[model samples]
Target: MENNIHGKVVAITGASSGIGEATAIMLAAKGAKVVLGARRKARLEALVKRIRVDGGEAICLETDIRQHNDLLRLVSLARETYGRLDVMVNNAGIARLSRIDDIRVSEWEEMIDVNLKGTLYGIAAALPVFKEQGSGHIINIISTSGIKIVPLQGVYAGTKNAIRTIAEALRQESAGLYRVTGISPGLVNTEMPDHITNEAARSAVKERAAQIGVTPHAIAGVVAYAISQPDNVDVGDIVIRPSVQD
Candidate 1:
């Protein structure tokens, strides 16, 4: 049994699908009580049922991370149900890839709101509670796009890079008080590309993902590793991608 994750209360955003869903199941199986948040109520309900059937502790709340209050409520639910929040995974994100000249202003704004501000709101909601407990873990899901900086991914990568910067700074400031980890995953089979309004860009990304995307479970395993570490050891940053990805 993994003692570090067992019985820990973990709240995950974007829990309806992809990385979030995989992480929820993985951690819950390891004996963590998982509180799930996402905009899709029906999906959340189904996931909760699945976890229960598997004899794992789980709950769900309808959440839209673009709204700060939703994040607050998510953290509140974890604490209320489990008595303390052990980990907060800022995994909710959107991708609207387009060249800067395409002038897709609305798409840019959407990425900024969901990808950037949403992460900040999660930090706002969890930091105080983590501080109160004198110990906690934050795992922010980032992307390799932020590291490689490809064309048509300018805005999307920018948002991820911003979170990477913030997570690092928080790690530095928190010192021994809490743990901060940034998980930058390469193309995984997820619904993120579907959010792209640009048809051409969407098609290209989807093709690439279909060819080389790793399983969401792979990323979830990485998250478990970060959280399972001893309290004094912080798994600062993890960048994972397919071996074939350039």
Candidate 2:
């Protein structure tokens, strides 16, 4: 079988750790030239070194997805390094679980900025390149919080669902010029919980995740499956979670 992933240049945001990091390693091992972007330069450097040591082509750039220019640079790095960008994975996000009554305005803004605006910036950066090339794929790492709304995650889920709606709209508007996919993962063992400011909420989430959270590698595999499909086949929305999770 022809390997659709081989030789493809894939740029991934949030590549420093968690889903992005796992996805980077998985895709690189499959022969994709990966361009990694994240704010953690040290971690990105370490990831790049690990990929190289494993004999996979990879590079890292200090990117804060909150910055539109950073996203543009990330895309440019891919094109300049590999001649074309075959895929863009908007995998950077954050979750600050708090009740709606709490009114953590700053935290809400932060989520909007990172989870929602950051994704928009990624699309803005990649769409032009994809349009010019007449072919590209966008894979967004969303969360199942959007699917099953509960207390303390109202804003976070809102941001995710916003992306869900945008992804669908983008897919419809693509006109076969590009592909868009949204992958919503539920309760994976990642550092996302560490970002939660509410102490009690953080502890509860941490406990729950430690018990039922699947590995980020599982999510990475889903990403690989989406990207490995033939260009003509657009794998739309996917939701993966531990069966033990509610």
Candidate 3:
């Protein structure tokens, strides 16, 4: 029984920690060659080493998805190292929660840059290669915040929703040329909360995440499941979160 995951080349952004790191490890353990990209060079190197020590093939590059060329380099690295790329996981994101009236313009711009534009850059980098190869998978790590919009998460949700819309459109436009999937996670134990600028918001989010957030491994499992399916079967959208989450 072929699981359909082995021998594939997967390139993951935000691969230094949390869901990206967990996904890289899980997929590599399942026999996929992983190309890891993140801004933290040390973390990427450490992840690569751990993967290698586990008898899995892996490599790393310092990538900031905010830069289009960095994404190009990531995809290029995967192709150059492994002959072809099977998957592109655009998983880098940031969140700065505050009321709309708070008007954190800089934070809003940052989220737009990293979450929205960065994802577009990833798609741009991978689409041509996938088109040439006639097959590839693009997986975006979306957020449930987009689905259940609240007061403080207006901008964050907007960015995620924009990606959601784009992903759906891409899926429809693919005409079986490739696969597109958006995995929406509600709350996972990750460093995202630590990056929030608002002191109260950070504390509240951190405390709630501590209480109910699922481990990154759980989301990693979802990623693996999506990839393990036959190429003809495209898992379009998945929302995985703690069962108790509203």
Overall local distance difference test of candidate 2: 0.95
lDDT values, one for every candidate: 0.94, 0.95, 0.95
- Candidate 2 TM-score versus the reference: 0.99
**Residue 76 lDDT in model 1?**
95
What is candidate 3's lDDT per residue for 1-246, written digit by digit as tens? 238889999999999999999999999999999999999999999999999999999999999999999999999999999999989999999999999899999999999999999999999999999999999999999999999989899999999999999999999999989999999999898888999999999999999999999999999999999999999999999999999998
For 4-65, candidate 1 gives per-residue lDDT tens digits of: 99999999999999999999999999999999999999999999999999999999999999
lDDT of 2 by residue, 204-233 (tens): 999999999999999999999999899899
Model 3: lDDT to the true structure: 0.95
Backbone clashes in candidate 1 total 0
Off by over 4 Å in 3: none
* Per-model TM values vs. the true structure: 0.98, 0.99, 0.99
